[model samples]
Target: MSEKTSASRRAFLRTGLAGGLAAGGAALAAGAARADDPLITDLEAQPWTQYLGDGVDAAPYGLPSEHEAHVVRRNVAWLTADPVSSVNFTPLHELEGIITPNGLCFERHHGGVAQIAPSEWRLMINGLVERQLVFTLGDIMRFPRVTRAHFLECAANSGMEWRGAQLNGVQYTHGMIHNVMYTGVPLRHLLEEAGLKGSAQWLLPEGGDAAGMTRSLPLEKALDDCLIATHMNGERLRPEQGYPARLVVPGWEGNMWVKWIRRIEVGDRPWHHREETSKYTDLMADGTARRFTWEMDVKSVVTNPSPQAPITHGHGPTVLSGIAWSGRGAIREVHVTTDGGINWHQARIEGPSLDKSMHRFVYEFDWDGAPLLVQSRAVDSAGFVQPTKNALRKVRGVNSIYHNNGIQTWAISSEGEAENVEIS
Candidate 1:
């Protein structure tokens, strides 16, 4: 071959090889590349890249990737007497967006998850109602349905932190909450069908679980946004979450969203049940107790860069994300601070800002490898602002466990390790 032809062919081969490497580098960077990472440089030799993967039938019901097994609902074994009657936290740091997955939603049970067949389940409306009635699961489904998204947060969420920073991770500190789209019949429609008596002013919803959990709810609230939820996130309710039926008391504590709900008794007065009187009430420093504190206050937390989720990639272009919510109304704004409240920056609120639902917020900045203190504060549409831990203590006192929506702080070290912390 002539020298000129041979040189042209060699140059073309070199250009083609460089182009391929450049394309592969871009793909690797998108997937979180490492300078000396074998996964990127030897991608073609990886087992999964060369093999035939599982078929469609492998997962009868779709499941998360095997790599995500670490993301799950977890319980602190020391928190309760038994697993059946205890609570498990959602892995908040592992999730994104507003909707919580059915499997990962937090679980709080008084007796344990009830496993009643849908065919055998029933809902009875008794008490002061004009017409006492019992409807089968199928019967309830026949009513006019509405779908709405809301965040159900246990009053005890962050309860452990009322005194100090106790839990090490966001999951345990603030994971007793989940947001999902619910499809169900309005409680007002059901009450009207049963004919509420003129004197009916309260409701006592009872669960079908072994514990038969019950709570007293105001009649006015029931007629407002309460729902007889049958499905969550477009699927039948998970057994841990109320199964065939549950109550959706928008903007209320999780206990009021009675799972395995089987009956609602309309009454002329509050039942002052165990949940409301002894357990869920807020006890004050002066020995006075606060009751009927139903609505969850404005709250926000830095989920990523929390103790469980630290910044793994060092130094530059760090993205911080978290969730904010309020039982009163939609969140109007969320402000983040990187220096323990000394300086605050407005975070960009992303996704739908629905009433009484979770809202995701993000803040991105270039990390300078300095030790940091991160926190987020939320403001709801009703003008309620999330309080600082000290500010909350001033009003509610440290003795109270429920409804503690104080801002949370995470101390980030120079190496990017995060720790749950409290700042004066």
Candidate 2:
């Protein structure tokens, strides 16, 4: 063979051998990557897998796992002067299901949480009644108890966004709300026992807090679904949630629920209290305010892919989850939009759609590595549909700080990051 032909043959063999080695190396690397996920993919024993967990009575009152420490109620320091008489938002982004945990529920107090001993507490029912009555905690428990789930929302929830999308996560904007099962006696039976006068038009519920929170509740609502609750989520009410007893006014603002309830006075008209006229009232641009806006409208928020809970995995099958609720009635349906409201598809409503309670929803789809503008709209049994921010502003004006139940938008980038945004 010629020298040039021999050299060419040798070079060709070397090139082919290097290429084969490269391919084998890539395969070995891929196998190692798969092997690294034994904690999730493999059935091998791990630290927890090999050992036994704590026994039954380890903790008489159990707590959540240590992994969930970040899931907590947070207060915006600038929103109020002090933590005691201020507000703290629920960590809605980390929560799931319809019922909110007792400890994680939002906290709002005008004077601070009251620390009243249940043994010393007394409930007074007076004014416009055939006979005034005082009942102790034990007396309250004996009055034909009932249990039901309901959502309690502050009328000022999302109030900061009236002018613009001021907050990032749903916990900051819409976390001033919570849903839980309450155990108590109906206010109707109690009012009937007291023999309400025909002339009584309203009931003034007062709390024992230093601020002495008070509100005028219509007689119709008092006889409908109002509850003087002492237990929440199958446990005794937390002190922050008005321990001992609080009025659970279903379908009304949280402020009207009257934590640490002390007295009930039957009256003929609204007392025009500070909370009703100066605080919770919606002030419009034209100077006229919408007063007594008690019931929260239909509202929904995408929880999983929010600012705090962003998409982390590569584009593929993605499950979009959220929560929807209304004060008027049960949620009938929820529609999700991923194209800035240009198109919408019905999301799967999960759990029991109870009256005046939160409903869980989920929408699943394969992502195509494209930017998304996501939003959710809820429809209540009363046929009331959630409105857009622009549509709500048109009716109530931007000056209104309370009752801002407009639809929210979360913009997701192609890289799987999410942010709060306003879409035209």
Candidate 3:
């Protein structure tokens, strides 16, 4: 090598062997420590492996790594009166790719987990239906089935933050959500089988679980791409995630998913159930409640560089990746900010960019060993931009819990750790 080139290489190692740093740290360290160290010329390396003798031989079904054992579905200690009425949040900060494992899907029951046997399960259509029909699990399956991926998010997500970022981590502020592919017969198919009468304008879906959770859906939505899903992420549903069956309301809040789904009643008007009336209403600053706020607005948050997940790897070229989505339509833009949301930069989104599905985006930048306030913004195909915390609070007061999809920010320390914060 030329003398200047050799000198520059030595300087680069002195500062930090950054690129492929996770793999090249030792290579550079060896050169500075010992002259006889072998150079690492090969660009590729073998993945770490544990032979059969290392652990259990096998399982009827596989699971995530034990290293991921810390990841779990969490519940707010005092959100509700009991478990059935409480909410369990998905560990969004801990996940990477889409497709939440069925076991990890967040649970929010009005009563408690239901013990329903598929043999006894029956879905009945009544009320304004031209032909009232009750179908067994097998009968429902006899019809055609379709598989699609979608995200289920509780409207109350980040609600605690409205009062002033009460929660410390994204796991708490933004974990009441999950994205998974469902395999099941579409709700439209079942509705068609029942044959809705001309008078039918609304539908109420009830769950079989102890709480008997229920919600009213507009007839237009009932027949539009809804699914009575029996499987999540390519497997039978988990007990906590609505075993046997659950409703999948695409581009809508999770509460409407109606886990342990059991019955559908066609109606002429909204049933105005407790969930739609007193619970899900978004009380505004003037004391007026914005009821029936079903569509979750476009929201985005930096998953990593947050309280639970920190930038453990310091300096050099770092990848800032996060999740973004819109209920109105497909996400069109997701901006990132190294210095909070003051000046934003476009992120490089990777993976599938489907309509009404989660889109993963990444931003690469050089970390200069300084404190940073990282944030993300999502814009939908409808040209609607995600609202700021203040903008949302200006309308919906801090007392409200549902339909708050404000942009979230993460503060990164010089030590490389991250914490959730609000940045104007």
Q: Can you tell me which runs of candidate 2 are displaced by over 4 Å?
A: 1-33, 36-45
Residues 325-407 of candidate 1 have per-residue lDDT tens digits of 99999999999999998899999999998999999999999999899999999999999999898998998789999999999
Order the candidates by lDDT, highest first: 1, 2, 3
Task: Output the better candidate (2/3) by lDDT.
Answer: 2
Score every model by TM-score: 0.91, 0.90, 0.88
Superposed by TM-score, candidate 3 places the C-alpha of residue 195 at a distance from the truth, in angstroms, of 1.4
Clashing pairs in model 3? 84-109, 84-111
What local lDDT does model 1 show for residue 102? 93
Q: Write the per-residue lDDT of candidate 2 for residues 68-169, one digit (tens) a residue.
A: 777889989999898878999999988889999999999999888899999989999999999999999999988999999999999889989988887777
Clashes of 3: 2
Instruction: Tell me how candidate 1 scores on lDDT.
Output: 0.90
Worst 10 residues of 2 by lDDT: 8-17
